[model samples]
Target: MVRKQTELPEAVTIAIASLRDGEKSKVGDAHDLLQDAVLGRQGCLRTDKPQPVDWAEAAWDEFITLMAHDNNHARSIAGQVLSNLAQSVPPETALRDLDKVSAATRDQMFVTARHVLQSMWKFGLGTKEVRRALVAEFADLFRISGTEKNPTLRRFDIVTGLRALFDETGDDSLLQTARDLISLEDDPTYRKKYSGVWRDLIDR
Candidate 1:
């Protein structure tokens, strides 16, 4: 659910503090609060809103720093917040940090990597330059992911992101790329499972 504009300041304050705490040291109430603010509990803010952009703008530097934090959880949370607040991030800042975001997709921790992959698409929503970079980056990732251990899971995520991009921009090429990804899967069972990620578009 969307949050009241008045409540955004407090939430952003807490989230940035929690994010900082996660960076400073691991086990603490800040870590827990950061997780909740970013991932959210059932029916809560869920960290999905763009309204936090104002607050996020203030914490932009901190978030960028946290993106490379030694802790994987901090990196993941930082990446997601940056993506969610992409619209608020200056275009130059987003462009400069795109590499860091790209690197997170290959993070050693699968969960952190997956979170980064899932949210990276939002960076494009901020500007045309970012959209171009994000699309190119994701396409390159799709081309390379087949050699990974969990190619199917990664492809599924890629296609899902492509589908969202298609929906936003009405880009048929994005859908076609997703189809190409599905066709590249050698394992029929995994192929089918991954195709299910685009079932609606495929069937249509």
Candidate 2:
């Protein structure tokens, strides 16, 4: 007979302590237990049947409460938890608490990914897919760039996305324009983002 996997008592302790709403803090022992329970590496609380999916839901709720914990550790822990959820596929679970996630991601790009997720609800984002989809609407976004009513989207963040948009829309001219727009941007990261595509287009 096979021995059953132990649901470490620590797992329950952490889950209970982490249940406080707005109780942000750095990853503590509770987070570790949560991670183990959900990730299954450290130890599956119930070996009989893995509880990663269930653990994930509880973690999500706990993460929201931790968002306002007023502690760097708590915020960071919560951020990682949410990021894991965003990156999951077949989406072991759907983010029913989208509004809360959105609010949390507003300050940190790490968290801001949740905002990009808005696109996911409609389309999806995985670097390639998001860039391709974003291109279809690049013109609309660009149209607002220099206007009074612009949406204030992070243009730098949209460069590669626009490149993809151009690819799908067959708007080569915009590629040249994009190259010109970023011509003076000193940030190498921004240049690295799409300069290759623009340079390749110019050469072609």
After superposition, which runs of candidate 1 have C-alpha atoms over 4 Å from their true positions? 1-10, 23-52
Residue range 1-204, candidate 2, lDDT tens digits = 112333335564465466443253423565666556545556422111222343344345556676666554455455445544432322322334444543443444433333342222221122334333434344334444444221233444345444544554565655766766666445687556546656677445
Pairs that collide, model 2: 7-45, 22-65, 24-69, 25-73, 25-74, 26-73, 26-74, 135-165
Q: Cα lDDT of all candidates, in order?
A: 0.68, 0.44
* C-alpha RMSD values across all candidates: 4.6, 10.6
- Whose TM-score is greatest here? 1
Return the TM-score for candidate 2, rounded to 2 decimals. 0.40
Please report the candidate that would top lDDT against the real structure. 1
- What lDDT tens digits, residue by residue, belong to model 1 across residues 1-204? 222223345655676666666645542444455445444432212123333334445666777888877778778877776776666667777788888878888888999888888877777666777778887888788779976657667777877777766676676766777777778778899788877877887867
Q: Which regions of candidate 2 deviate over 4 angstroms?
A: 1-27, 42-52, 85-95, 108-189, 193-204
For model 1, the local distance difference test gives: 0.68
